[model samples]
Target: MGRMMLKNWLALLTAVFIGLSLAVISIVPPSPQGLDTPDDQFSSARAMVDVRMIAAAPHPTGSEENAKVRTYLAGQLTALGMDVDISASTLPEKALARLNRWSGQSKTEQPIYNVIGVLPGADRTKPALLLMAHHDTVWASPGSADDTVGIASILEIVRAVNETGQPARDLIVLFTDGEEVGLSGARHFFSENPLRNKVGAVINFEARGGGGTANLFQTSEGNGDAARLFARAVRQPSGNSAATYIYRILPNDTDLTPALKGDYAAYNIANIGKAEYYHSPKIDADALSESTVQHMGSQGLDLTRALLSADGFPRKKPDATFFDLFGLWTVIYAPVWGWAFLGVTLLCYILPLRRDMLRKDTLVGAVKMVGFMVIGGVVLFGLNALSGGGSGADYYDRLAAIPRLEAVAGLTIFAVFFGTFGRSQLSENGVLGATLPLFILAVAGQSIAPTATYFISLTVLLCAIATFIRRSKQTETYGQWISAAVAAILIGYMVSFGHLLMLGVGPDLPSVAILPAALAVLAILPLWRGLPKRVVTVASIASLGLAIAIALWIRLDPIASTVPLY
Candidate 1:
């Protein structure tokens, strides 16, 4: 019994280490490139020069500092051989009122200047490709990561493009003003600027935090052609259809929001790590992550070059389901493929079931899994509330608490998993039964929201395959290893996806993590050997205690020092 327990512990540790390593690798941004990088390459060192200047201080729209940023950007564009103009326009009445309210001023007139630069191509008749970033900052924030990084990336991209010679079509650089206030500058340009007619494609850079991998989070509707183009062009891409689908339903908006009104293929890219730094006054050029800038610029440069060299822009087609596999490469397919995956999953699960496997154990397992999700979700919600979630919570303060909140969620999840399932050695029937709920969910998701349901279907499919492999080779050592390998892949993806979800909405809805945690648990259920009751109880208690402690710390802690005074 002692030897058996030791082997079980070793196997569990090995699987965990492999999964964690993969998760870290998948989420970590690339190393920053130095100024010594080739002129034709996108270097964060080169881009940081622009970031230092643009984000030296807050430059909200209508501020004097904004004028300085606009002028400096126009000059940079001109030096890169582009024709530059400052398109000045009055802020809309509603926008001006909001600004006044925030500033405690009653000014009736405020002007926003959009810096427009045109780099003519060999054939001017071709539709132009626009690279966009805002030049404005929120109040009290130096805004290095928010907009400066984006602006700097575009400058670096243009310099790199110039080094490679003229593009096939015109390249338009748009540094919009008033993005933080209400996207006033973008609204003006997309609505009234005649150049809008010339734009066939747009790549807008944005940031929500100081660091992390930049993901192509949003694309125009009917993004099949556009997504494929991105997959083909980007060497190190980070994105998925799930993100686009979720963002489409969310109430959030970027400058891309207005541009979507135009008939153009659009991509909205942003990094969302170090989420606490978002809109924080402490965020400055020095606080920003150079690797994040490099990641953004490198991906942007690759996609821009591809678009510039293409014969025509991507046309409207049904959106495709896609995701990057550990940031190595993208896997794209039609939404209909989800149904096929489900069909295969059903086959894998059904093929191995015996008459005895269809008994009460299976029902118990299904009930256990359902209970895991419900109890875990409720615990997460309760913990988030303890950490000052819900109404009247300070938005920026919650953003700042993300790292700690992630820890609390993670610890609580471990506690829930152990408390619920760690004490039992599930039967084959029980393991298969556990997957039924998620499988049903995948089917419903496929029927209603196919694009976002790939992860669900893929998770269930992988779990089913692992179950079949384990049952077929019940006594084989290699079978355990194969199942472990499959578990590692699923767990790694769930970890990374959970991190992203936490960054995106954990501040208010950390309970959402229960879905990924449950999925990951399903993958590991087959390998689980019942732990001693005392051990399981101790682990669950310790983890839950730590999570509760963290929640209390977050609740009692003062608002972040970096938070804007307003």
Candidate 2:
């Protein structure tokens, strides 16, 4: 018995380690390329020179520093063999109001200068491809990550394109002013400039944090053709229809917001990591993540090259479902395929059922799984409240606490999982029963939101397969190992997905993590063997204590010194 317990512990530890390792690898951004990298490829070292220059100080609209950055950008574009100009326009009344509030002065001169450059292609008659980024900062922030990184990435992308030779169509570089102040420059240009009519497609770069993998978060309506192009062109892509779906419903806007009004193929890419550094006064070029710059620029270069070489812009088609596979490659397909996946999932679960399996145990398992989700969600909500969430919390301070909050959520979920199921010896039917709730959710999601339902459906399908394998080889030694392998894949994806969710909205909604946590539980259920009651209780208590301690730490810690003052 002692030897058997030791083996079980070892197996569990191995599976967990494998899953965590895969999760870490999936989320890490690519390594930064150096100056020695070929000129034809985008390099962060080349980009950082521009980042350091443009982000040297807060260059808000109408400031002398803003003019200096504008002049420098125009000169660089000219040097890259482009026809460059600075278009000066007055900010609208709404933008002027925001500028006045930020600067604390009512005296009104609302001028914004937008930098425009055109690299004439082999066929100038074809519509132009635009690459855009904002050149302005907020009041006190250096804005190294918020917009400076975006500007620098465009500069690097243009240089690489020049090295390759003229594109099949014109390439337009737009460095808009006053993005931090209501996207004033972009609004003026897209609505009034003659050049807007020339643009066929637009790729806008943006950021919310200092580091992390850049994601293609938003695209224009009917993005099937655009997404397919992106999947084929970007070698190390990171994005999903689910992210685009969520962003569409959120009250968020980037410079792309104004440009989307035009008849153009549009894509918005950004990174959301190191949340504490977003618009922070202390965010400087030296503190920025070079890997993030490389990730953004490399992907940008690939997509630009592909579009510049295509016969014409992608025509509007029904939106497709797509996501990257642990950053290795993208999986894209029509939303209609989701029904087929659901059908297969159902078959996998039903095919392995036996006449001898007890219906009573299956019902109990289903009830327990539902109870776990509800109880876990409540605990997460309570813990988030303790960590200074909900009404009256400082929004920026909560943003700074995202990493710690993610840890608290993860540990709390682990505690809840153990407390709920650690001592239960589930039969094969019981394991299948535990997955019923999530299966139902997947079905509803597929019916109502097919693009976003792939993750849930895929999770159910994988868990069902694991259960079938275990049930078929009940007396075989290698059967559990095979199940463990399947669990590792599912856990890795869930962990990475949960990390992203935390970065995106955990500051306000850590409780939303319950969905991913429940999916992960389905993977673990098939491999679980009941533990001693005392051991289970001790593990649960220890994990819960650690989670609470982290929550208290976040609550008591002072607001980050780097947070913007105004």
Candidate 3:
């Protein structure tokens, strides 16, 4: 969009975005009980160990491993004097019989066992708090971090409270199975073994990644008594300053949310349920790989740290207004990046394609440069198998390791620039002929596919085009444009792969500055004689680039600890 249209769009979107953001903000489940010092009964951080050890009692999932865990928990809970139940998904004869017995009764079917331990409380009529932690881990990796942590936490808490002779309501410790594969254990338990009315609440301990700050929220959407409990159960100022309480409701639900929300959202659907936390930690078994977070890190936060961290945390906005305002900017400007790209392409197409507009030196240089680039492409192909795809950070690692790349790249760039700086008789065929390499790269299929080599070749070809334009421009000597071109590519490196190198994402790179710097260098004709050509040709590209970078930076970094957000 042009300046006028962009201005209008931003203004309109800002208003709508703010309004919707406010609406979303209001829907999160509010902690009703409010933050209370855990010293009153429960502690700030509790570990569930014994019941976890007990719940590891029977391996109903049929795997010898899961059975071992089940056997461990059952023995532990039985020792605690609570009733124990077992179910298995192992396609075992007994588990099959159990499933066959209940076939027509409910839609949910999973072999699971329930281990319950009761700790008598002060008031018998008071609702019993259901303490829960899943005993299951993913299929491969040890669930130690994903939830051995959670299970152990629950068991320890129950042990402490029970041993202390605490007075209050009863505590029903639940060691759930099949939590890794699905909420199979919990679902079947709830369906088959409905709780008594005295069961007032449930506390599920789930882990995301490495343990840092634990985010708490109600499984039910909208509002409920559970919301109040969360508000109260959460201690203030929290343990980790870096910790973020993602206690706001998003627009969707996870596995556990459906059952809870179905019962809970029944209370306040009109309010359009919201939440601050859901199970979002990445466990190894959930098909997560280092590459999963690494690749997605391109489009998201430090999910690895978020999931795995036990000490660091997600910080909440000091005021809700910040999120509202920032979310508005994101909603409004997200599309503008694509629009900016399209507008530039259209302008490029519309502008008069004039061969005469090119300088004499530029034409000659283009020819030589294109020739060298063709040679480079063939060489790149010949050496193809040496490099792998996925464009992993490994390339950067190896590139940095090689001192030759910097020296060779620098020398080659200069040589090409000097070689193409000038030539007198520039025929149409010769000039058009020079673009063959560039045409191939620009028009090729997406890179990073089976055609990665082709993509690399294309990138080299584009570099040639940059050289052609750089050589043809008479404003500054080829040296200046060449340096700028090199710098532009460096700047591109920072943008395309910059986030990875930053250590991790946060504000530092203005993003805007990168493009303007690169463009000022590449668009050398702007400073030379062809003023109109520079404006329409060079400046057009430069200005458009600057505009895009600014819009994206604004959208991405609306609120900052560094710059004045306004």
Give per-model CA RMSD: 1.4, 1.7, 19.1
Best by lDDT: 1
Model 3 lDDT per residue over 60-145, tens place = 24356676776776776666555565644333344344434433333244455545666665565655656666776543334444
Off by over 4 Å in 3: 1-60, 78-83, 87-110, 217-219, 222-233, 236-255, 258-566
Which ten residues in a row are the worst by lDDT in model 1?
473-482
Instruction: Give lDDT per model, in order.
Output: 0.91, 0.88, 0.35
- Candidate 1 per-residue C-alpha lDDT over 346-373 given as tens digits, one digit per residue, 9 for 90 to 100: 8888787677988898998999899999
TM-score (C-alpha, index-matched) for candidate 3:
0.36
Superposed model 2: Cα runs more than 4 Å off: 2-11, 473-477
Kindly give the stretch of ten consecutive residues in candidate 3 with the minimal lDDT sum. Answer: 267-276
List residue ranges in candidate 1 displaced over 4 A: 2-8, 473-477
For model 1, what is the error of residue 279's alpha carbon versus the real structure, in angstroms, after optimal superposition?
A: 1.3
Instruction: Give the winner by lDDT: 1 or 2.
Output: 1
User: How many steric clashes between backbone atoms does each model show?
Assistant: 0, 0, 60
Considering TM-score, where higher is better, how would the candidates rank from best to worst?
A: 1, 2, 3
- Positional deviation of residue 141's Cα in model 1 after best superposition, in angstroms: 1.4
